[model samples]
Target: MGRLCKLHIQNDFKEFYTPQVTEGGVVCITRCDARHKTPLRCVYGSCSMTRAGPECECSDRAAFWYQDQVCRSRISKVGVAVGVPVAILVLVTIVFAIVLLRSQRQKEEYRNNLRSRSELYDSDDGNWDAPQGFAVGNPAATWEDMETPSTSYINLERVDTSRNIHIRRPTVVR
Candidate 1:
């Protein structure tokens, strides 16, 4: 009975001894090999012993890498590669759209300003007519009255034809 009691006490202490103690106190209770087994399987990773006892070393696959402690959450490198350019393209498109809308608005404003100015200047009610005196051919005139004289003589007596003028002729190069 005494030996059985000692064994039970030792077995009870064994449970406490299995846990590792660090500066932050007790950490993992199970060994790395046991933690890697059936019930406590580390998905997408393998268990390894560290200073904190057992830890999961998550595998980095071709297109994705594990991000969380459990190795269940993944961050895709391929997704980032594709998503970044698409985001930039969307941003550029939005900027171009905004610029185009602003340009159109400015042009419309300019046209409206021009229309308002023109309307201000010409405020008449559209019934304006030229005076009868200013009308074409109101005063009957012969076709010969509109004809210009073919010969016009200049007063050459007042002209200064005696002024000396120099003309340079290019010499031919042999």
Candidate 2:
């Protein structure tokens, strides 16, 4: 059972990922293949060395800056930086759409109610007329009795107030 639990044919390095056993657990990691070692150098971690080096000594637990075959780190900072704003924008758009849809629905309902009431009122007289008291200063006049008024008006208001004032000649009283 112990021999079956030991991994000996893997290419990548893993830290503290072995299965528990009755006897003990192995902490030292060994590479079965030599193709995982790369010439890349980490730029943001504690050490500048590559995760998989010439020797089998990488623990595979450091926060490497880049993703390689041996060491792939999490990108939580970048994910949160972009994901939070995108989530907020999506939520705001959804809320705005819902508000606009509700307002349009309310307006449609109001128009429908007005139309139904107008139909019921116009049922008696087949001729559709304006609502009661809608016409100002023409309560008794029907639509045919109203006439187009003439546009003859006088513009007598003084509009040139900014011009120079005329000086009155002094009387020859001297």
Candidate 3:
């Protein structure tokens, strides 16, 4: 137990022990692994510590954290193929609907002219038959009777513009 303590942990002398070379208790920014796990060893307070150890600390632990990073496509190749055709189909359907609407609009004036002439002839003949089997949707079985006339008259105002007056608002109390 009389072995001279040639080594010490600088800024930390709380523990005292004799350590062999393998028991690397050298003063360094990083902790050194000692074979006997007794911490650093040195000869006569020499500032001979090198920062790096002979063998790399990270070597043994590398396999546990190894990652095989590779680039991945956001959309699958098959999905891209299918989606392009579907998008084209929707665009074609929209164009067809637009063309149909335009054709109908172009014939609107002719249709209206025919309707007015036919209506005039219908009125002259005094025939109320829904023209040529046109199914005017179903009529209601009952209807409301007029209880009162829709419009009424109310007296408006007397012109009292004799003097200017300021109005005060009533204050509310909680």
**lDDT at residue 107 of model 1 (Cα atoms):** 100
**In order, what lDDT does every prediction score?**
0.57, 0.46, 0.42
Ranking by lDDT: 1, 2, 3
Q: Using TM-score as the measure, name the better of candidate 1 and candidate 3.
A: 1
Q: What TM-score would you give candidate 2 relative to the actual structure?
A: 0.33
TM-score of 1: 0.43
Question: Candidate 2 — worst ten consecutive residues by lDDT sum?
Answer: 132-141
Winner of 1 and 3 under lDDT: 1
Clashing pairs in 3: 24-40, 25-39, 25-40, 25-41, 26-40
- Per-residue CA lDDT of candidate 2, range 64-170, in tens? 23344333354455667788999999999999999999999999999999998877455232333343322123233235645532332222352344667689998
What TM-score would every model get versus the actual structure? 0.43, 0.33, 0.27
lDDT of 1 by residue, 1-174 (tens): 234334443443333224445587544344443532233457778865555545677887777877776577888999999999999999999999999999999999999999976653341322212322111221222244454334333334544576776999999999
Best by lDDT: 1
lDDT tens per residue, model 3, 87-135: 9999999999999999998789779989987764452222233433332
Q: Pick the candidate with the highest TM-score.
A: 1
- Which candidate, 1 or 2, has the higher lDDT? 1
